[model samples]
Target: MSVFNQPRRRIVVLIILGLAMVLIARLSYLQIVEKKYQRLADANAVTKKIVYPSRGIIFDRKNRSILGNDILYDLVVTPAAVKNIDTSYLCEILEINKEEFIKRIGDAVKRNGRVRPSVFAGLLSAATFSRLQESMYLFQAGFELVQRPIRSYPYKAAANILGYIGEISPGMLKTDKYSDYQSGDYIGLTGLEKTYEDVLMGQRGTRYIIKDNLNRPQGALENGDFDTAAIAGKNLRLSLDIELQVLGEELMRNKIGSIVAIDPSTGGILAMVSGPVFDPNLLTGSSRTKNVSKLFVDPTEPFLNRGIQATYQPGSAMKPLTAIVALDEGLITPDFGFPCHGGYTSCKFIKCLHSEAGHAANLRAAMAHSCNSYFLHLYRMEVDDRKWGGVKKGHAKWKEYMSRFGLGHRLGIDIPGESPGIVADTTVLNKRYNGNWNSCSELYVGIGQGQVAVTPLQMANAMCLIANKGSYFLPHLVESIDLDSSDLLKKFKERHTVAKISDTAYHSVIYGMEDVIEHGTGRGAQMNGIAVCGKTGTAQNRGIVNGKAVDLKDHSVFVAFAPRDNPKIAIAVIVENAGTGATFAVPIANLMMEKYLRDTLPLSKQPIMKRMLETTTIQLSKLETSKIDSLNATTGMLTSEAILKKYFH
Candidate 1:
């Protein structure tokens, strides 16, 4: 115990006191100065409500609103706050029984905890909402009404294209893909709705409301300091011409097929029509679920979007593609002719459709006449050409060319559910023919038959390629998103070149197509002033029926691009179970072109339009007969008589 020890003890005591004072100062600052803890305590008395943003509207190319929004009311309930409210009176207002009311309350409690609000009845009608609004005050803090937005379609056309929004499923709620979504949220189920879902579904906001002791919202919490404003979704402008869509749908009534038209300039879809389509309004509002069930079970499959989903052998409509390939490979000149004795010498499976003398002709004449033997010979020569090492190598090169044309792969269209048409490669051929196959083994591909299958979209796109002479933009439905940021559509705006072939090769093929409409198999598609370059196809059909292989009627197909020089529209039309390509499909294409280009049909053409509108190839029952007799009486041999003679003869 010296004097220095005493000084050290005093210093230690002073340091301890200073540390204690600092701790007290920090506690005082935290308790009085900061509002974090105060907000935490207030959270117990506040309710956070999610504010759903309104979905964007959809407009056609003409700026017409095709889809719009409608206000709907939902009855919500908090099971814990519910008291001795007149159960019978509430049920009467809601159009439900007392037992059903109890069950709904129990369900709400099970779905969301007792203190949370849950939907009791959703998408209430205007009359029901009005009735409930009068009695809403009597329900007290337990029941409340919330406003929601629902979709409405004014045009009632393009149901398959516009698609429908549906409630989120339990599985979707669990998946990471829908992590942002909660229960009771609506999501796009198919078509363009599903494609642009993220952009169309805007950011959801939150609002904090002060709750009283009875759990009723008193007012905005903290004067709305913590509330975030909801953002409306971005709008979408489509390339679809609603008027043309309506006309195409009308022309395809009572038929089973599809038609797709694209603008050759920008590759924007003008019209996409699938037959047996229902009014788009049927799949909206309160009756959506019921109508969906009916459409699901319908034998005709009205839900199918045949334009990009269904695949078929394109028939002679593929001749133009073959002609281009042949001319590009230096395999034949535009004037190269092939002799045909009514059928191909290498293979007897395909027969010439033209006269024997006419079958011995050049590419343009062969295309004009749709001579099957000519194209079959061209396919064999290209595959057997000695420049490529072998048939396998040559087939691979051919597949590469087809893939460039956007075949054998998805075209990356904005819409969902697009099927990549089949183009046989070396491996596919080897597997199908057991590696011993030769050029003749897959010769049917030359005429766009056998293993080759294509969607109506692919056929139209192939025509687009020919129309543009080699390059094309990706076919797209949505033209622009939002107001000024078309940069979001960079993917579709990029130009894609399928073939590097010379323009001369394209000219040869294009001239052949022009001749097809001028006086060939596709003469039915000819217009007076518009020069339509086209090709007709009658695909052989074989399918399993009643557990046996049967020969069904050929599929009628036609592909064309108008004004041969500066093409505006490229189109493909298909009619299933129809007799010939020149019968039902060509006339439909002719009318579609006339409507789109001229914007009106001439008086002389009204009778032809009437005849087309009246024809029904559906054949719902064997006892039901087609209106081909009526078509024959009005449109002469071009429609029914000549097609029937060619098929049965």
Candidate 2:
């Protein structure tokens, strides 16, 4: 009793006060600051049903719905609600054994806990749904059929452009970026679907329902005051022409390459096709898992969008650009000439198509005939200009001009997985030549070989620049998104101008391109009434096997723009392993141009369309090595020799 002094009593009282403050502060945080515990506490009594909004409909240029939505039924289960019922009957309905049924239940419980509902079986077929619908009342205690909306392609066109969607993966669920997403949520995995997901996927709503101790629904919680209505996703209107897309796919059928067409003025994509054409329907519904696994192992890689993803040496198609760069740099004039006798005399290995003297008398004639020597000489002169100091500096300057033309990089197209095709800078050139290179060392680039590589999309965009005389809009897929005020399309709307070349120089280039379709190598691309400016390219894509050059088929390529003055459409076509550009690419391009310009093919051109549809340049040996050949076989895609004979003969 004597030890209990006043100062000691005051100290004990202060300690008690501090302890009370900490307890109060922590309690406030749990009750007022933390929302997760509150939701969990609410889950004990209130069942929150998520109201999923309908995904946006994707429309083509003509307001035709290419991509829409369809309903799929999923079998969902609540482990806590599972009760005394015919377990054997349920297993029979699901076509699963006892072990599988137990394992699935355990998986569902472990995934989302016993109190919450989880998907036991997803993407149920119509037949299964019909069979289960009649007896759903029997299993009402634990199981329910929930309607899930899925992407549907009505025309079955633009598989690579529209892309596919799937359930969110487990790994994505734990991240803060995806904390809003739940286990059963779906997300766009690629293409325009993934690029505009935020606009395409609308706000999700919630409905609170009161439940009994047995987890059976009692009634709406608080007379549905807590309920929020779902907001449907915004619609997407694209610049794509559905009919053009269909025609492109048909023309490109059985081939391994791409076709890209764009509107020169607006830079809107008209059509983009990556062949062999894959059915978008296969990547949706219950068959998606199996089809995806098949596609994953396919050697041909149908999943790759060749229009933007695959790169190639542009060949002679790059000559016009070479000339434009040289002219713009004041290194050459429109009338400048280079004498040729079968090849470039300086670079003896680089051959020319014309052996006649004075074939390269002028720029227009040289380009029309695709004179290798003239363009090569032009590239060397431009890069080795005295103003640029040396080859390295000149090359860097040349590269800068190329970038302005939208080469050597992605054009920021609306789709994902677009490759920034190789445009060798000094660093790459140094590495390739061990810092001992000169303009002559990379002169083959003038002919679009060597260090230059470009995608079909890039080529098409370059065509747009040429058609517009060194200006272009960013190539874009979506034209507008409903209710969008964020100016997502501002970048595409701005005009980008490159190069300060004179109008006379443009005239020479345009005139040369006109000659190409008129009477040159690209004559097959000619249209009777329209002024079609085009260039043909036969690009080498080979390898060194056993330290020796391996002989392989060259890729056929063509780039063109139509009606020359105030040009409307710009296009690029590539056919892997095809012979000459005139053989496959030029004809396909001509057909596309005629269709777009005239809006109908003349009766005389019917035979050309027929022949194109029946052709297959893809070697059968290559097809046999892929899972696509076997998988496509199931869908009446004839991969056998009979098809080859039928098409070729």
Candidate 3:
């Protein structure tokens, strides 16, 4: 009792009181001043949301439509919010059975988080959605409809050129790089869609919105300040002219091959048609999934872009290029002719054809008559000459010419599956022959028979270069890009230069090419008042003969550009198994050119030609039979009656 009454005891009591007062004041500040922080935690826990943006448009050069816009609807589900989802009732509303409903819901639950929503089904029609909307509220986890822009092809041709968009794959979804895409997201699967995916598919937009207790969107979060507007995909105005494309497609109706047209000045792809084309609408909107599956499973490949993918030996078409190389290398002059004794001589093999009458004259006549013997002589003499150095040097120089003409390499065109054709390296030849390769080993290459191969696109572009007198543009389908709100694509339509040749060389080559249409194998492609310049090719292809290989058929090819004095359009046509260039390929090219320039062309006398392109479904049937017969010797399936109509009707 005496110690408590002392001055030290009184001071300790005062310090304890001050500490207790401070603790009480801090507790009051936390409960009253920081209470708003707790509301944010509650808001985040219950909110559920997603944003979808409009897809981009695809257009023709004039912004007239190639692939534009169409309606696409999807059925989406949120598993956590899906309560009271009367299985039988909901299924009936959505036109699905109970089993399907369960499967969809189960998939969504497994694939996505419990609170997050996922697409249950895709490509729904508007009529189906109307019925679904009536009882959609009954689904415990709510279902909603999202309208998306599906790809549409207005011209309905060019399916392989425009390509298609498809759903994202599960494997792709698993990759960290694809985190931006959901299961329902569409991707460019082929053609230009795949080639220019980045430019065509714009950046996705995003928005935030507050949700109520039921997880429904209340309104724009924070008054719309937190939204990202989706940038619409750039509209691709392809260099393709719709009218020209339609004419080409119509001309190739019953044929099994490809036609490619380019502008001499711009490398713009005016027309591209692969025969037996399935409708682009078949790959768009509601029909896309079912039709694409059918197309994929069909034996005949309607999806293959034959213009750039199919490699064919240039054949007689290579004659002009060979002549050019010879002239450029100073191996031959206009009058310094070679005697085509109907063949060429080599130590390893003697190369000759069925032709006994070879042109014994200048380069001009050899090209005019398409004399193979002339090319054989020139190749042997030039390659073996030491003036331009050794055989390797000659071959390299020849390769350079090929490259200049966009051969033995992939032309930078905007298409998928484009092959670089086939060019052999010296080392490769040396290895194959055990270090004893000769000029004679590659002798056939001079005539485009050995290892030289080119695509129809390359052939057309090469012709354009010659027509333009030595310069070319990078061949392109999309001539321009258009934004949604502007008429600014004009700036993008400028020409893109690829190469330039000398004027003298260009004019000389043009003269020889002009002679081809005037009095040569390519005479069939000549049009009235068009001044067409052209070259013809008949390439031997393999076939089965008495249990052995034989060159039983030929690929007919024709390359030309119209209005020889001032070329406007250049075209290449290839008809598979068509026997001769003049018979099949040249005629088609002529018809197309006339339709483009003069608008008056006659129809083919062959009944098969008339019927091959009756309708997409029917034509595809014939193509299927042809493909099946090509692949299997044992399959005894006859051509479909629908296809037989072409021959018998």
Candidate 4:
């Protein structure tokens, strides 16, 4: 009886020991080795906040702040944590009605689940933030304040050049280009802001904090061991001269036009003015969406970066390239003379403005007078030369020369939305004229009319080529990024050779341009002491009027470089529907040159400045209506008949 009872007792003791070991192992796994339960516990008791980095600042060539940073506050909401609070009182603090409060809560829920935070009201003023912060504790666990960096324009100028930032769209978030971005991140939408977004957008950081049972942050988790500090974006220095830019804008105000000024030495833009531009601050803060909507539908098209995006026929402003091409090809000498009988002999549609009897002229005289007949002769020589065999080959050669000059191409500017313009290559000419075009058929291109078009930027760059005597750097807005940045900005530092024209040819052409400002068509552009080499152009365009195609008055265009030799600035100015380059564009170009080269206008030119500022080329009614017919009909038709008669008659 004793032996059998001993064996059963040993077995029972063994089974109890095995069950005890299993229970100990399960408790150890849950308490120490497994992290899922601990993670779940932390999720309910910790808050992770994203820290946004400050955007980079922008400075002008003179080190003046063109764009700066300002601190703004956002009202953030966590829908799930909202409890029994005074909803009406909170809405009153936010200055929003009950309906808006409900809608924002719903939106916050839709954007991010109820547990996550979303922006309820963005870009609040300091006064409003102070009022709301005073009452913030009443809405604890449901509402909080987040600081955001917003752009501030101190000079209130260069809106088109600096651009604006806005929230990234849902479409952008889906694309590979913006893969690093999230739903509420801001991105540059245009101009330099868009081009240098990578360098300007600094690295964001994150911080973790312990929360209490009420879901309120108590303190940093683990003494801030997991917290990461935000890295501020790199600063940028621009090539623009803010004073010159301001002056250009003032002069071009109340007009529909653009002005582009470049440093021929560096190809860095000095001043770029697109008229009818709005205050850049309009696109910032609480009113941004509303203001953008207003601008989007505005008839004047203030959003268009006309300096780079708007294309015009370029008028006689294109003749300098023609002269250079002819001289470079050795088809014509500076001394080569053409007898102008008020028009091209082969093309009566092209008229000469110099004289009814016509001037027997050399290249310099033709350029000074902007003689259509003479340039027509030169254009024909370049495209119909016997050495090239035929119009097709000669035209191809001419097209090649144009391409080298940065015409009919993007020119690879750092800014976005630059137009290549119309070069009327062999393919385009074939399409337009059904392969029946010849040198004479496209002779209108010789005078900067017909299908040949250019932007103010391209025109200014062409003048840079002439000022540098056949070589140029690609035009760019940014001068330098911070030293630590790894960006593609170094690409702009390279030089480009447009042509191999002789110095002698340049001298001859320059002499003609000098005469142009001194005593010829561009005489209005003359400064008291500076010698400005300039050319005037009247580009022809057509528009529909009263449901019929009508001839619009030509666009006024002028291009120049001064003090002629060792030129400091190369510029192009275009005034739409403004008759004669001398009337509108020349004076503005002269004023801008004076302001930049001399730093101030002479007392004698004060009257001219006043007159320029007061002149209004755009009619208010037409701009307000924004109808296509109204825009087309009012443009180029606003020039006084007296001015038209003086130029055309």
Answer with 1 or 2, whichever has the higher TM-score: 2
lDDT of 1 by residue, 1-649 (tens): 6544698888888899999999999889878886545654674477767787888889999999898888887788888888878888889888899889989989888777787788888878788889899888788668888777788877667888888888788788889999998766778898777888888877888887777776667898668877898887888899999988877877777688999999989989999999765677666666668677866766667788999888999888888888877887889988889887677777555667665685557777788778888888888888888989898988888787778888888887788889987998888888887899888888888888888898898889999999999989999999998754646688888889777788777787888889888877788888887889998888788988889999988888999999898999999999888889999899889888988898876666665667666787775663144332232233222334443232234
Global lDDT for candidate 2?
A: 0.87
lDDT of 2 by residue, 449-507 (tens): 98999999999999998999889999999999988898889999999999778889998
Residue by residue across 340-427, what tens digits does model 4's lDDT show?
Answer: 7776667556667766443546888787777878888889999999999989999999989989999988988788998888888898
User: How does residue 93 of candidate 2 score in lDDT?
Assistant: 84
Q: Give the range where candidate 1 is weakest over 10 consecutive residues by summed lDDT.
A: 628-637
Best by TM-score: 2
lDDT of 3 by residue, 256-358 (tens): 6789988787778888888655567777666567666666665556667788888888888877777666676676776645555555544443444434443
Off by over 4 Å in 1: 1-45, 211-217, 483-487, 621-649
Q: Estimate each model's TM-score.
A: 0.89, 0.90, 0.82, 0.89
* Candidate of highest lDDT: 2
Q: What is the lDDT of residue 264 in candidate 2?
A: 94
Candidate 2: give the clashing pairs.
Answer: none
Question: How many clashes (backbone N, Cα, C below 3 Å) per candidate?
Answer: 0, 0, 11, 1
* Model 3 spans with C-alpha error above 4 angstroms: 1-49, 93-96, 174-179, 207-225, 341-360, 483-505, 543-552, 598-649
lDDT of 2 at 101: 90
The Cα error of candidate 3 at residue 224, in Å, is 4.3
